[model samples]
Target: MNGYHILLVEDDSMIGDLLQKMLVREGYQVTWEKDGENVLDIIHQIDLVIMDIMLPGEDGYQVTKKIKNAGLNIPIIFLSARNDIDSKLQGLTIGEDYMIKPFDPRELLLRMKKMLENQYGTFTQIKHVFIDAEHKKVFHRSLHQEVAFTAIERKIFFYLYENRDRTLTKEHFFDYLWQLEDRNPNIVNVHIKKIREKIHDHTGEIIQNIYGEGYRLNTHMKK
Candidate 1:
């Protein structure tokens, strides 16, 4: 939730400064661009985009087409003063959400939070560890370090994180690892052991081992 990078494309200095300050204070890393230039250069790193219709060069709609054509699925929100029906329809057609100028900052924050949750899912925290499943990254808040995982370890952890609180059978993991040459059921145990060690869940508190069931990433350990 804290590390979401946002691209704010607005030419108005007043609005851009206000939004940049607000977004940063709300725990977002923001990049303010006066126009549609250099979007593709950093599009992959951007989690969401706040676009303004009126700009110095290519309009918001045109920039949106470039983004879409680049094959990236980054969500865009149009924040423009043009609140007419035609503009709204056009904005909503290409962008995910459209908001008019002179809008409430609080409402914008709420809408942004909702949109981000819907797009990338809310973060899952287990003890001092925070899981960003969509971005495939985990951070240890206590130590202020990213928890590294091997490719297989990351896959297994992601699977468990995606289905947190649900019991995923060994067969589920086996089916997941079907493509691997070594489809041994014990591989799940090995990877889970490594994952638990990396996350410092030595007592199986975060990743629980059900006696009859398979395994479940217990969200109750978040406390």
Candidate 2:
């Protein structure tokens, strides 16, 4: 956890800086590359890669192919703005995960943790619902394609998944995600509603509102 080295391939200075800072805070050594050229040069030192799709000269797909062709086995997570199914499918074939842009910091952290631990095993199976944490995606057979979730939605889903048996109050999420003790916590309600709709947990919403005590993932939910 502390000594892990990650090569970050992102061209946008602002996004790259924020991601680097967050990963460093989580105790990982990050060697950031703006373009796709130097990635091959430094892949030997990296334990995992968090790459952006739209890079300088070469896109993520090309760079990933190069790395794989060279026989460097590494977990690559694609963090890009391309939310299309085609893009997701193609990236997933080469990389470990394909995350859409405007991602939650916590989701990225969790995926990175999972990818780093992939040598041991993957996350526990949650039935049909595939939590593509590395990709920051969530989907099931009911939805033929991936259900896009915003940064907040991913945070909510991941939190509920981790603590599936427990009820989480709005204040809990507000404090944990937003890192603030807010005055109006109804925004949490809005997010919960959206997550339910996107994932298609209608009659028995996977996220059940506790009427008075916030919400929790319904244990009765399908496998």
Candidate 3:
């Protein structure tokens, strides 16, 4: 499971039901509510929100303001039928994004994923490991224990993760870990060896050695 929870505040039964099902199918936990009522009661449990502008009582904008006023930093995307520029502007100003009704579900889903990743960092399960960029930690899926790392190892791991798929040179690590201090390039190799061992990547599968380039974290590993 993706393991992120979403709060869907949509009054239309058909739309809410369809969205809830799609989100669930995409491996997200969803809480569907018809209106803004009872939002605060369970807002803490929500990781992100899909809001509707028109509702039985308080509108999405008002509800969003209240949530923000309460010092919550949850990301929200306004989904509504209103296509007017004014409505879109207001929604965009208050929420992270705005999607008009009759929108493509695929696009909406993609946006949700990007927003979640941007806000909470890259969280994905790949094979036996769960990389939680937000927490700066990795967990063994079956063992149910965190993959411990040294301070410098953790920094290097996350730096590679945050820049996944892009080969980071040895100089990048030296600059990141100790600025202006020339350190042995082999030190990076040593730390990477331990990191790979801890994460069970003995064959350089996930953390690939790019020949003469450097190292890269390939997060697209099959689950």
Best by TM-score: 1
Give model 2's TM-score versus the native structure. Answer: 0.54
Give the CA lDDT, 0 to 100, for residue 6 in model 1. Answer: 93
lDDT of 2: 0.79
Q: Over the stretch 1-223, how does candidate 2's per-residue lDDT look in tens digits?
A: 2546788999999999999998888867789999899888878877788989998788999999999999988889999999999999999999889999999999989988877776423333344454555655675532224678887788888888778879998777877788744547678888888888876777535677888998988656546
- Candidate 1 yields a Cα-based lDDT of 0.86
Best by lDDT: 3
Question: For model 3, how does the per-residue alpha-carbon lDDT over 1-223 read when each residue is reduced to its tens digit?
Answer: 5757799999999999999999989977789999899999999888899999999999999999999999999999999999999999999998899999999999999999899888877756766677887678887642136798988899998999889889999988988887867688798999999999998999998899999999999977776
TM-score of each: 0.65, 0.54, 0.62
Measured by TM-score, how close is model 1 to the native structure?
0.65
What is the lDDT, from 0 to 100, of the residue 10 in candidate 3? 93
lDDT of 1 by residue, 87-119 (tens): 999999999999998899999999899998898
lDDT against the true structure, each candidate: 0.86, 0.79, 0.88
Pairs of residues at least 3 apart in sequence or in different chains that clash in candidate 1: none
Q: Give the CA lDDT, 0 to 100, for residue 62 in model 2.
A: 96
